[model samples]
Target chain A: MIHSDLIRRLPASMKLAAALAVVLLVTAACGGGSSSGGGDTAGAAGLEGKTVNFVGYGKDNPWGAYFNGVFVPKLESQGVKVVDLTTMDPGTAVTNFNQAISNKPDLIVAALLDTSSTVVPIKKAKQAGIPVLVFDGRPDPSVDADVMQVLSDSEALGTAAAQNLVEGLKAQGRNSGNLIAITGTKSGFAAQDRMKGFDAELAKTPEYKVVDIQDGNWDPTLSGKIATQLFAKYGCSGIQGAYGMADYQALPIVAAAKQAGCPVGGKTGLVVTGSNCFKVGIDAIKAGTLYGTATEDPGTIAEQTADYVIRYFNQQNPPAKELVKEERVTAENVAQFAEQCSKA
Target chain B: MNVMSAPPRSDAPIRRPGRSRSRAELVIDAVLLLAVLAAIVLALTTHRFATVANAKAILTSASLVGIAALGLTLITIGGSAVSLAISPSVAAVGMIFLSAQSFGLVPALALAVLCGILITGVQGAIVGYAAANPVVLTIAASFAITGIATGVSGGSTVSPTGGGYDRLNATPGGVALSVYVLIGLALIVQWTLRRTGFGRSLYLIGENRRAARAAGLPVGRTTAVAWLAAGALFAVTAAFTAAFNTSANVNLGGTLTFDAIAAVLAGGTPIAGGRGSALRTLAGAVLIAAASDILLLRGSSTGVQILVKGVIVLVVVVLVHLRTEGSRA
Candidate 1:
């Protein structure tokens, strides 16, 4: 009787629309929330009393932790009130951006979580004349007018890593063979952009063919699994070079390949390289196993981001884009990064 | 040993509830036989299926899931559905293990296990003393542990600084220490299940809580102790997992809850509870690993692997439910 009365109270169309409206309203309410109250700093015009809102992605990630621990403190030392806001997903990123715009903080910095879902809200923030800072991802161009992006140059890093691997391969006196690449999540900006630069560098050498590029998902186990399969398919002698999108991903592939009787490095046979130069990878390079790796320090990225926000707060028109330097580290220069090896 | 074929007496006072032991044993034997036959098929056709390295890899992976599942199995056998808290709890303990490496690897690993025990023990106490729903309490515990873990590390992966972790990762004589740990834990769980007063009380509470209470049994204490033991087992799993990966991420236990539940149910444990064995779980672990290996060997994608796992779990649940109903008739 209750079900019949409820059904009779409203048409199906009205019920559907009412339910949808409730869902959207609930989503908007839940999407963006303040994660931490970072306390205030004291000073006049030195960013003391100035509020900087950082709209972040999920906290359970490398970027989230780096931005929180490293970036937040950097902002506070200059005497600023920092509100670190976070979202669970891309939709939440958009919602948080809108919530952030309503607050109208002196400046807004965010890690772009998605290409499509986050663009419109970020554009809305810009239309409202709130200066926006972004890192790690690029949104649509029309929406990019008031947004300043600060991130690593993926292409240059990839090219440098590729150059190291190709040269290592040539040192082995191997002219013709297939080179396999393991990338991060295929949909991620890093994978697509870095692969573009890597493929271009590989193309410069006509003898080495880019045979297969598989998605390692930036997970060590998945990368290792894919490595074993590739080794089985290509055999030890047929494959010449290997590239991993990150040091963590590379470590497992190297381990699996070794267990499968496929030796790597110049001394053994294959040329292997990793990016995001982790301490372990540096050790591998020094041990003459890894050919090279590219370093894009997370702390450095956080520093650049904080500097950009502070500059915008200091009044003058700041640049729309800021990119940090990426260094290619190999056995020759591995000693240079030894002091910061354990930072990762 | 032959609970299935033992002489049946009409006036038996301590018979296992629901289906007769023989029928349940029959179903389990068929499932295990199929698992073994499948492995034999793969060893005959797949190139590396029988190799020591591949076998070690499969066992190492299985052993982690197996240890966690064994802990959850106590909860399931004791009449609760399953602990949703385990996967996140494992990840939290792994982080603890990595951070506590300042005190040396063994001491740090022991601390991590203690953390797991305390967390789940608290949950079990709440469920026992307050008579709270175990599933709901465990779900809350999962969130609590994950939140704590995320706060501790700021949600990033961490690795121990000391170079001695590699020793834990090493497999002596081509067989991983993880496999031996699994076997030992399974044996311990079996002994506890059959040879202890608390174990029998758990069976009674699972069968009928009201009856257990009326019979002057300490139901709440027994339940709490079982959960506490289960928690320790879960932490041990996390410890070995940290050793295996040499790093711990927030999502390190990805797909583990699903796999554990599947392995438990597919291993012939009834969802209705009351009668199940730790020995059954060992066979379940082998079946799950063999199934996954065979699928991967045949180049099955993630979707296909999941599909097969789902179907197998479904077939098992249906068979158990029908068998239970048939016995009631």
Candidate 2:
């Protein structure tokens, strides 16, 4: 009986050791953080002739123009050729990416507005022996291992906006009042996260009363419409400030408030702030229309994505993920960033 | 006259529960009433739901949607509930107005209406003459129009950089103006349906097509005219939407189709044909807006809101179907 017990324990101990060794090896591999593929560039240095194609949304918007015009130039200065197959229509653009992958480019970079729509294309790209790098959008968990993604701590964008609003209120010496939040399309991930972030931060302060939240569908007209009525109903009383999801949204809120003859800009105006660094929002900040706005640097994201594609091409160890930082652009620094953006 | 008799029935059930809905034969009326109730309830219960601000917002958002619903009402009552690609047609036409806003607001708006009328008339003529399936025909027309809009705008939103266009959209009483436009459209459509002989012919053809054919009704001409009217209405709505949004994109009228269709169905327009009123559709549109607004105020997610709407639409459609069949049986 003793001999049999020893035999059973020996096999169990060996199995446990083997599992522990596998986990330890993975931990070591992941913990060792040199994205240069552990200096494996000896053979990859000759990858100068490779081409990486990129497809994204908002192809004709100002964001796209900067990415294509300025960021592409930055990457090309490093000897990487970038091909664009981009469009604004979510469905159509995803299809374009699917077709682009069939040709098997060296690498592909895509920014899917909605993660759900891009799954098929991303999966197909990965399966077809092409490495796909996604930026500015979340990825589905099932498909996460297939492609690498770059994201921002957007929740922080929300908290920062809320903090700015709180400070503005404090500057006005507000102990109690209503604050309305105007959100982008209610279903969008960014809209929900940003709203939650702002809401969570605002909750920390007891005196500020959050009255209502409405979805503006990220349309200026809709935001203006919502703001117009909110101003007329509440006037400059009760409501101390407002939070908008994006600059596009902030423009309308400002317009509606201005139309209603409500005090705006500076400390006296409705304290408005948002995420997404559109030129209009930065201008709004400088003009004292918006209190604060978050900047993601789309051009930087584009440039970084370009760099990532280059890394994959060079067979350098790719980082599992990358997170870009967003800074709150207020009246203090709106001019500086605005100048750079305008130049782009 | 005796020879033009109702078709013989083959042992159909005389009546069914939830059938014979004469009280709500007009779906639009019920939809309208429901919408009004929803708005009142939403505004009352939800914080800041019924505030003047929300009302203004609702009206502003509803302006173009309300106008588009009016056009759809005309088409539905014209004996065929079809748009002939009215949505995208108007969106494309409105771009021209937006592009030419430097001239003046009145002229820009007028040109947009004209463009819309022409596009719809052409479509009406083709669909009328071909006698094609409205679904397939309108789908093709939509695709073509969307392509054109994309080509014209280069798949981007084109804002009125500066001009009367901005002034018109930003006019302080923009909401009121939109409401007045909707009222005027309703009155005009009501007058056409009730006062004109062509209107009676429309109902006649819708109720009994073969009988109307025997009575020598100009069915094709009526459909063409109705479609043209819809096109014109859609054009105005598109212009308003573009002006209000301060931009025009390829998906300008994308959301209107579902809204318009929902309003029409909820208002009690029988899909089988020939029984609805402008009043009913107006109410339906309001109700749809009110429902969405209520959900929005409740802080519901977009997905949940859409799901609720889908369920409501499904239930209403089933009821409408049952009522239609029960009335006949």
DockQ values per model: 0.17, 0.14
Candidate 1 DockQ vs. native: 0.17
How does candidate 2 fare on TM-score?
Answer: 0.75
CAPRI classification of candidate 2: incorrect
The alpha-carbon lDDT assigned to residue B196 of candidate 1 equals: 71
Q: Against the hidden reference, what TM-scores do the models get?
A: 0.78, 0.75
Evaluate model 1: give its TM-score.
0.78
Question: Number of the top candidate by DockQ?
Answer: 1
lDDT of 2: 0.68
lDDT per residue (tens digit) for residues B1-329 in model 2: 53224332211224557654455455644774785687567568877766665666566556667788777876776556666466577568767777878878888888888888887777777655566677777889887888777655655455564457655445445354566787788788877776677666666666666677777777788777877888788888877766655456555565677777777777667665666777777776766666666666666755666677676667666766765554664
Model 1 - which docking category? incorrect
* lDDT, model 1, position A193: 80
Which 10-residue span in candidate 2 chain A carries the lowest summed lDDT?
A34-43
